[model samples]
Structure formats: C-alpha cells, structure tokens
Target: MKDLNKQFSLILLYALLFQGLYAVEIEFNADKTLLDSKKEILELEGNVSLKYQALIFEADKIFFDKKNDMFSGNELKFSSLDNFFYGAANIVEFSKTKLTLKEVEFSTCPCEEKIWWIESDEVSFNNEEKIVSSINSKIVVQGNTLAYLRKANFPISSERKSGILLPEIAINERSGLDIKVPVYINLRENLDLTIEPRIMTQRGYGLTNELRYLGKNHNGFFNSSFLQDDKESFQVLETDNLRWSFNFLHQQRLNKSTFFETNTSSTSDPFYLTDLGGFMSGLSRTLYLPQQASLSYFKKDFSMRLDLNSFKLTNPLAVNQFQRLPGLKLNYFFNKNNFKLVLNSDIAYFNKGGSFRNNEKESLSRVLFNPKASYLYNQKNYFLESSISLLYQFKNHQGNKNTELSPLFELNNSLKFFKLSKTTKIILEPYINVAFSDQKKIINKLKIDSGLRFNPFKHKQQFGSLFLSNQKDIMIGTKLTHTDKANNHFKFEIAKLSTLGQKILFIEEKRIDLPEPFSLKLKYKTNNGIIFKSHLSLDSKNNFNLTSNSISLNFNKYKILIGHYFARNIEIYNLNNNSLEQKKINSFEFSASVHLAKNWSGGFKFINDLEQKKNVNSVLSIDYENKGMVVGLAYMKSLELDWVSILENDTFKDYHKDRFRLFFELKGLGSIGKPKESYLKRRNL
Candidate 1:
C-alpha cells in the first residue's frame, strides 16, 4: 500500500511538472534550496521555515515534492490555528490538510514551557475534518505523567466531541476514599451524555448517568445514580443494601400558549441523601421525597395548571399525611380602569390507606375558590387601595363533607416624603393596613397542601413596617430610608398589629392576644463592604419584653451574626402555678470569616445551645488558592442535641470521629475533600 501511494504521488508529480503553480504560494528563507526538474522534487536545508495556506512549518531540513504539494521534514515544529506539534519526523500531504508526526509532543498550551502536554508515539490530524487523533498517548502536567491512553480523539475546532473529562477524588466519613471517572459523549448535534463510575472504598461502587436532549419543541435532562453497598453497616435503618436516586427535569412547549414540565426527585430511601457524600445529596436531607409533574397553559392574563404529585415517606406513621394524587388550578386576573379583578380556583383529591391516623383508610377531596376585587387611587407621593375578597371551601374526608364561606375586606394606604440634597436623599414613608372578615370563628385545624395545618389568617410584613393579614386584622407602620451618592443606604421601620376580637396563632401551636407589640428593624449598607442589620420582635403584654431578635454585622472581610428566639416555657410555672415562665430559646449561632492575604483565608462557624452549655455544630477551615492550585484544611464536629433527649432530661451524644480533611485541587482538574463547603454555602453560613 505504501509503494502504491508513492507511485501514485510520483505519477501526479510528473503529470503536474509541466503545469505552472496558480493559487499556491510559499514564502520562506533558508540557507540552501535544491530543485530537480526531472525528479519533480525540491529540498530546503538548514533552518528551513515555510508557510503555505494555513500551515506553518519549521524544520532542520525539508524535502518537498513541489508538483504534488507534499512535504516531509526532520526535527520539525508544525503549527496551525488550532494545533501545535513537534517531532523528529513529520509529514504534511494533500495541501497541508493531513498531517502525521512520529514520537510527537503536543499541547493546547501555547506557552513556552507547555505546563501541561501530551506525548504520543504517533499523532495525526485532518484540518478539513477538524479532528486530532493520537495512539499510545500519555498526559503530563509539569513534567509529571498523570494518565495514559491507548487512543484518543479531540476536536480541533469549537465543536462538541467525545472525550474523557477530569476525574474527581474525595475523602469523607461516609465514603472514606472515593473517586469518579467521567466520560462525555456527544451523541448528536443536540444530544449529549455523561457517564460516571464512582468507586468508594468504605462502601461499594456507584454509577451516575446524565443524559441531555434538545429538540424543536422539547428540551430537558435526566440524571440518576445507583449504588450497591456491600458493607450493609446500616441494617438497623431497615433499608435495602442498595441505594439510588433519580432527578428529571423536562420542559416542552406544546404550542405558543401551552407548556408541559416535570421536575421530580426520588430516592430509594429517605436516609439515602444523608448517607451520600455530595453537596446536592447532603442538602436534600428531607423526610419525604417529592415528585411532581404539571402541564400548564397561558393566554394573556389567564393561566391554568394540571399537576400530579406524590411522596415517599420515610416513616410508616407519616401515612397520616396526604399526597396530591392530582390537582387542577386556575387563575385569571385583568385590570379594568383603576379596578383589578382576580379569580383563583383549585380542586384536589388525596388518598391514603393501610393503618393511617386511626388504623383505617383515610381520603380527602377539596375544592376552593377565591375571587377578589381591588380599587386603587394612585399619586406621586401617596397611594390608597381597597380590596374585597370572597372565599368558599368545600371538603369531603372520611365520609364527612363540609362547606364554608368567608368574606373579607381590606384597606391600605401609603404616603412618602422625600428630601433631596446634592449627594444624599432621605425618604420617610408611613403605611396603614386594616382588614376584617365576616366569620364567627376560625378553623384552627385547616390542613392544606402537604398536610401542613395553617391558621385562617396569614401574616406578612411589607416595607419592614406594614403588616398585612389575610384574616380579620388591623396594622399601622412607617419606614425611613436614606441614600447617598457613595452608594450607601440605611432603612428603619416599625410596625404594630392587632387581631379582630380573636387570638392570632403561631406555627408552634401557641395563641397570642390581640394587639401585638411593635416590630422594629434596621438595615445599613456602605460602599466599603460594611453592612449592619437587626430585627426585634417585642412582647407588649410582658412589659414590652424582647420576644425575638437577630443582629448581623459585616465590615470588610470580617462578619459576625447572632440570633435569639423567645418562647414561654410551660414546664416552669410561678408560685401561683398559673403563670408561665418567659424564656429565651436556648440557642445561639456565631460565624466569622476573614481574608488573611490575597490567597489565604480562614473562617469558623459554631452553633451552641445556651441551656445545655455546649456546641451543637462547629466548623473551622483555612484555605489557600492561586491560579494553579487550591489547598485547604477543615475540621468539623457536631453533637446530636436531640429534642427528645432534652425533653427526657437525658444527655445527647457527642463525638467527632473522622471529621477532619485535608483537601487539594489542581486548577481545571478536580478536588479531593469532603465537598461540604458547597453544602455550607447553600445553607448561607
């Protein structure tokens, strides 16, 4: 085959010998050039350099069949727009589109040292196809060999191609030693997949698959991970030895006005996430796994949805909670003149069986409708709005059916005064909101979505001072704000709320009397990365005692945060046995971080139980990072601090086993550590 190709090239060269060069142009300077008319050959020796079309070549000696436009060289350095290659023997043929190099050293790094490179026994590339291929190649970083491959294909253009991504390594308590190898495959123009195999020394192995697709009308991704745990160390959890999780997100445009979506997450067991060692897995620690699918339509000011949702409960006793087998919701709103009209309707059916709340099957179907109308009077400085709403609810549960109707009225007003200066401005705003509902009593046990009981009224604060209540209520508030040309801002607000002849309830199942105390809040932010914020809630009945408060301060690279919660302790009674003890919640949280240098930083965070006089969770870490690498050392410790143990007057468990990690990372490569920093960042700590 080689002789045949050489003969064909010779024939072509002889055929083109009489033809003069047309579009071909070459320019270079060399110590000597030799041309043989009969042989149809040209040779350039001694520091030969030439450029033809997109090819740039430099060699100690070059031989060219000028008629056929073929070049061969020794100790050649070859380069093009997308690639660079150096080898002792190099070949360029067919108008410089096809190249082959023997014992070549290649790299994407165009720098002098080639900090990262690949050495291949034989490397080839085709500019027309924009593909580079190599056989028996080894990857080296800073002269250190890191990986070897029998064959590899990499795209020379800005195209998606199949290749191996950087591998991942980590060490943590749950997994001990872990590594993940990933391969990315570009299956089509609009489809791709990443397959990763995870090996964990402590447990077993896992595989993660991520498939993505894009189409004219639909696009989405499907990701899943499966693991087999041979250790079976958590048999006491009553869970299977195999763990797995799946997440699917899909969106499809059915038409111009309709869309379909499915955002779902499901795991084999509720504790699977807690046992996993990823940021996503750790942050998803929940008792119930959620899966939902919905199809929706929109037209101008109207929208409708049909949804299906379900949950997997970790505990059998949680069967009392109902799942939305299917639900339909509709919303329509439009403005006519200065009046706004809105209508909302929802209907859902829920079912549960097998030893539920009362050891019997339980089912519930609900229909709710709400219509509201609001009239607004707007001005530059002041605005007033009045809204009226009608709510009707129908429910059928356990062979019992009930219907209720409620009417609500609300009034809101706001006024703003602004004083302007050359470089500063101050604004003072006062707001008032009053609401009333025509209902003799409220339903204290109105369970809504996800089986969460809700008070008849919902409380919300606006502008930091104005309180809005969905139930019968009244509120008054004011806000003051100042801003300067330096981009500094300060805001202060105070608000008060009063119930309409009924007690307001809290999520903790406690009721409060009418006329709640004034709530005050303050916030200040400066251009120099300084911020101060505080919020306080007072108990007016208890001589205006502090019910709850939180303060946060941030100056440059340092920050401190503290929070206090107040509650009435029923366990402790005064001498009269009727008076309860007003107590602050026995907990405090503190966190601070500072940047010690341009590439060095450290931080510490801790949560302590003041009553128990112990730390619940604490973490300390120091990190160093530059363009090339990142290193960190972190220590973490946590105490159980179980509420059940506290109730029973028992000491909680405390231990810090294998809670420290030393991390290292190479830029553009991967990291080895616990990967808990992402979890902590997600928690905003």
Candidate 2:
C-alpha cells in the first residue's frame, strides 16, 4: 500500500510541474498595505499608506490594479508625497500630463494658497495638453473675489484655446459705456483676445475686440473697434461714423538675457481718439494714421532703445499733419552697482496741412551722458545714503534760430534714525536735494528743497519741507496709520496719487522753466483704523497749485473712501504748452465710495466749479459679485447741473435737481462642455 501511495504522489507532482500551475501570493508591510504577486493588485487598509511615482495615497481603503493600470479607493487623499507640497481631493485621478481632482486642497511647498483651496464641483485636467477644466469653482486671489466660474476651461495648447469671460462697464462724470461681451480667447499660452458687440442709444452698432499677448520672452497687443453711429466724441465727420483700429507690440529675447522689442499700430474711422484717448485720435483721416516702433537689446550692464512714433493726419484740426520723430534712449551700467553712464536724445518734427497750414516743422533733441558711483550700507536702527548726478540737455527747434544747452548737477542725501522702546516707537529722517542748472531761463532758476520727517510711532510721519524753487513754496504735513494695543488700525498718506493713479503737476511746456521738480506727500493711519491722506503739489516750475485729500475707513468687511480736491490749476493735458494758455483756475471736488464683503463696491463723486457757482460734474457707480454672477451699473452727468444755472435764478432753483447714474453689469452663463466628456480621466489611487 505505501509503495502504491508514493508512486501515485510522485505521478501527481510530475503532472503539476509539467502543467506549470500557479498559486496566489501576497506581501505585507508594517504599514498594513499589501502587494500582490504578479505585480498587479495592491490593497492598502488599516491606516494604509501607499506610494507610487512621487504620489502618496492615504485613506481607509485603497486598491490598485496593474492589469488595467488603474487605481482607486475611498476616503482617499492624493498628495505629492515628497514635499507634501501638492495634493488632491478624497478621490484623485492622475496621469502623465493630466490630473482629475475631486474636492482637493493643495499648497506650495512653503504653503501659500492666495485664498487657498479652489473649490469646484468637478475638475478634469490633461497634463500633456496643459488643460485644466473646472465647473462651478471659486477662489480668493490677492484679497479679491475670483468666483463663480461656470464650466471653466483653460487650454494648455498654444495655437488655440478657450476660457471664461467677464463683463464690465465704466461711468464717468461726462459719459458712460458698456464693456465686455462676446468671448475672451486665451491662445498659445500667451495672448488674450476678446470680441464684443455692443449697442448704445446715442451711438450705433459697435464691435470691440482686444488681443493681448504677454509671456516670458515676448509680448504684444492688437485691438480693433467698429461702430455704426457716432456721438459727441467724434465731433469730426458725422455721428454716423465708422471707427476701427489695430495695435501691435512685440518683445523677443535675442539671447540668454538680451532682448529686442518693437511696436507698430494703425487705425481707421477715428473714434479711437475720443473713447480711450489713443494716439489714433491724432489721425482723423483714413489716408494718414498713427504708428509707433521701438527696438532694444540689453540687460543689467547695458541697455538701449530707439523709437519712431508719429500720427500722420490727413485731415488737420488746429494742429498740422506732421511727423513726431526720433524718441530715443540709451543706457549703460557696470561695477556691480552704481558706476554707470547714460545718454538720451529726443526730437519732434511738426508738419503742415489744411486751411490752417503748418509748413513749419519744429524739433527738440537732448544729448547727455553721466557717470556716477555710490556706496549704500544700512543697519536696523539707522540708514544713511548719498549720491550725486550730472546731466546736460540741449534743445533746438526749426522755428527757433538759436539752440539752448542746459547743464544740471545735483546732490541727494537721505538719512534716518529709529528708536523703539517697548510700547513706543520713534523715527527721524532728514533729506536734502539740491540741483543747479545752467540753462537759459528766468533769473535764479537754481532749485533747492529740504525737509525733516518725524515718526513717533510706526508709519506716523510729521513732515515739513521748504522749497526755494518751482512755485517758491513751503509746506508741512503729518500722517500715520497705527494699531494700538487695542487692535485698531489707523492709516493715512499725504502724497499725490490720482484717483486713477496719474503723475500730476508736470508741464511739458515749462520743462526748461524749472530748475528742479519736486513733489511731497503726507499720510496718516490710526490705531483704531481710520485714515486720511493729503497732497500739496505744484505744477511746471511750481506755477499752478493743487491740494488733494483721500480718506478711507475700514470696519470689518466694509470699507469706505472719500476724496476731496482743490485745484488752483493751469494748463491742459496733451495739448501743446504755448498753443493754449489759461490762468490758474479754482475748483472743488468730492468723491466717496463703499465696498462690502464678497466683491461689492460703489462710488459717487461730484466736481464743482465753485467760482462759477455750479456743479461741473457728478457721477455714481456700483459693482457687485455673487457666486459666479457679476453685475455693475454707472451714471454720469457732466456740466448738466451747471447748464441749469444759466437760466434765471428762479428757474435754476426749480430745475428738478440732478439725475444720478443708472447702469449695471451682468455675467450670464455659457459653457464649453459637451457635459459628457468621452475621454474623461479615471480615478487612480
């Protein structure tokens, strides 16, 4: 019997060995994750931790199948396992170039989200394609509401792409216009272009399109607008006017750090002038328009730029159809820091045209090269630095028989000392800048300005300055924003920042009149969160004067702003200096604004010609956003209230007051999805 059994077993083993039969096999790790034989299925449980290709998965249950090369699990989380730098939702699907994340929160290696988690109902991505698609997503970026994107699609491909769209509007005291329609196209990972069709009761059919491309090594923009009807703005030709324009700007890197850039533009029909106030406005005729070009290559130690820009007008207004030319600049630097030299040249030629012929072409050009060196070293409680610069400029015009050369030298010094004793802080800074110009100008045109600033606490400045040139002015100001031990913030700055951020008080006409130009600002903020800022400015050579004030209050999620201006102003912007002359005029202005939580803001402003006893203009605007929906409205009434004052006192008094704005913005819905994506990504653990 034993012999018979042994023979039978041996026969069975032989049959099994020859058949190559297989058995199940598995390996377990201390973490409780298990790997199966055949290198296929991997199961992870009991506080399971699984890692694959820089991706780590953590969940109550996880599984992977090598057969189909698919991964999945529940209560799962996917993250960049190494740096713990990036991750996705409880359910994540990742591939070479694509990532499909569900309810995922990710961060930079250092952990900063701007507003952090980008929440969405669904997010599908393509890694190789650089495509990221999200539906119903919201995020907070730069403290601004970036919300309510419905079926957002961002294309990774450069040649073609589509993304979300946002609409906006503008309301000024004089006019109002609708903005943002059609679709915004993001292409080639660079340019952003938009096409919109709009209609206005005062203006006829119109379509506006803008294309802007900005990238690491290059950038450019092209814009065109067409309108069927015209309004008061065009004043030329007819209100039934057609308007169109195009702009191109490009920058390219010539080497690792060197680059060349050029810009040129053309336009037709002429509305480009009155709307956005572009150079195209200078060309009222189709035969002649405006164009500009510039090219440069340099970095760090060397740089140079040559510009050729002009508006060729076929139809002349008050000015001639001339060419504005030769706007050029060159610069060079070395010695690791300040040891450097610079030379610049500029010239403008004016031509002639129309019944108001201007055959006379005039030009202004300046050449200067300066070499300077400086040393700067500062410590915690004190800082001191000083530098001197030399510059020379020359001017010549065709009409002016004589040429004038101005040589200017100046020394600048800044010093500061700080002391902080527990609850109290103290700071003192004294600055002096003196410049001497041997230019042919009114007597004693040398410029001098000096000031002392004191800060008793952080950001609280008590500043005073005396100026012997440029309007021969003297002023004193103090400003500060502080938060006491009580946890309140007070803020202020007495500097010049236009409501729209424009550098004010520079008169091109009198560039040769003033020896030196200086602007001073003072602002204050409180420990309890109230703010006030004011600016006292002098225009070209300090002939005209201006006082601007801005106030802001912050309380929780609500913020309010108020601005007041008193202008003893002279000269108009853009117009030639000598062409039009007006004495310093008086005006008073007031503006107020309010902002709420979740991106809602509104503002109102009224400018009055106090000398004329009438309101020059007034405007009100409002904008709000609600979870993917954006709405804005504005109203402007310029010189309307003043117009009523032209009537008799009784009639003016009874003129039924003034009308405010009535406009709004709406972001309707449209999508780029078939909803059912056939190539959708599958989940991976």
* Number of the predicted model whose TM-score against the real structure is largest: 1
What are the per-residue Cα lDDT tens digits for candidate 2 across 1-685?
0111111221243244335533212122223445464555555556655554445566776665544444567656554534433445655554444556676543322333323345566677664455557777765433455566676664423335565444434323223343434676766666677777665545556777778878777776666666665567566654446666665667777678556665555545333443433311222223234455666656876777766556444233434433435555666665545333443333333223221234544343333344444444466634444444443333344434332333444444445555555555545555443344332323322111111111111132111111111221222233343444544444443322111122222233343222122345666677556777766666554466655677777666545555555544343333323443443334555655566456876666566776778766665667664443345555545553322122111112111123333333221233221111110111110
**Candidate 2 overall lDDT versus native:** 0.45
Total clashes, candidate 1?
Answer: 0
lDDT tens digits, residue span 140-187, model 1 = 877899789899876655567777776666556766777877888999
Reference-based TM-score, model 2: 0.52
Off by over 4 Å in 1: 1-98, 109-114, 126-131, 135-137, 145-159, 277-283, 314-317, 353-360, 442-444, 451-470, 505-517, 540-615, 618-680, 683-685
| lDDT value, candidate 1, whole model | 0.65
How high is the CA lDDT of each candidate model?
Answer: 0.65, 0.45
- How far out, in Å, is residue 412 in model 1? 1.0
Question: Candidate 1 has which clashing residue pairs, if any?
Answer: none
How many times do residue backbones clash in model 2?
Answer: 39
